[model samples]
Target: MTKRSFDQFFKNPRHWREDLVAVGGDFSVDRLLYAYTHGIFPWSEDPIRWYCLDPRAIFDIHRVHFSKTVLRKVRQKKFRISFNEAFPIVMQACSYREKDNTWITPGFIDGYLELHKKGWAHSVEVWNAENVLVGGVYGVAIGKFFAGESMFSFESDAGKIGLFHLFAKLKESNFELFDTQQLNHVTWQLGAYEIPKLSYLDRLERAIKDMVPWVIPLSHD
Candidate 1:
């Protein structure tokens, strides 16, 4: 299968929720990886229509905030976090519709599962005391960077546990950056801020050159 070239996304990466570059392109694993490596991603509100976004706002590792509430929850140890253990399950869970709608369509799941199989994508799962999976965050990882896709929680603060562990582990492993893609109310609360596209691309260029394997240290508990 021939994947679409990244050049087709746009000539410039600096923009704020402007417009779709191209729609209806195949979401091939190669294509998806290429998009992420180039700081572009596919977002579809209706699933039938996909837009490629290159956001100015991104999450820096130093800026990923933990509020007092989130900090307290992380301290509670209510969930056990694991990585790449149950990606298919977590992907399905992230795609599950808690609200009236969802963008994680069948197409999206199949494409990402392929990426996961190739080790270009990964997930961090949070399990409950009973060993049931409660929350997870899945994203594409190229080299030293992780671009977060979606996170879902079955319990309060479950998703935060997964995220906290992900950030902690990445920092320990010498990872360079985590791209949350767009800045919104949700991402803002998580400490994502806007940078010029030139600034981000410079960092991304270096990040994608270094390899930092996804690893989660075993909990002594």
Candidate 2:
């Protein structure tokens, strides 16, 4: 499929009125990278709609919050954390929500798996005492910017544990942007807040140009 630039589809000023931006594109690795670096992302996959939200949501790497209960779980070492250990499994887990429909289609998985193999995507995995997977989060990274895509937990507080570690990794690596895409209850608890789209795009432009490596430690608990 031929790829088109963001300006091509976002010419209508009305497109800025809502978060939808543009619809119908392939989920190729290059397309994904281009979209994300430009403050755009694919939230759905049937026809593959791309979005750059008006009020973009993000977490300040240095200002993440952990509830007292989550802090206790962290202090107790309730789960083992690993980086890039099980990217496919983590994505699959995030896609399986019994109570709601998911936007993560098979094509989306394939596209991101390719990105993982190319070192542009990464995952933080949580494992129980027996080493079975319990929770995880996955996202794409470009330069100093990281776009967190989704997370899932099978055990209480497990997903939060994964997010805590992910934030730590980003902070440690001097990442400048941590885009959660949109705010939800979980993200709100983690200290995510919104910035106007123009502000977000400005930050994104600088972030994607500053060279930074994803040198997170292999594992943590």
Q: Where is model 1 more than 4 Å wrong at Cα?
A: 1-19, 45-55, 211-221
- The RMSD (Cα, Å) of candidate 2 is 2.4
Candidate 2 residue spans exceeding 4 A from truth:
1-18, 211-213, 218-221
Query: Cα lDDT for residue 114, model 2?
Result: 94
The lDDT per prediction is 0.75, 0.85
RMSD of each: 3.1, 2.4
User: Quick one: how many clashes does candidate 2 have?
Assistant: 0
lDDT for 34 (candidate 1): 64
User: Which candidate gets the maximum lDDT versus the true structure?
Assistant: 2
Q: Write the per-residue lDDT of candidate 2 for residues 44-77, one digit (tens) a residue.
A: 8888887878888999999999999999998898
Number of the top candidate by TM-score? 2
lDDT of 2: 0.85
For residues 136-176, what per-residue lDDT tens digits would candidate 1 score against the true structure?
99988787888888898888878877888888877776778
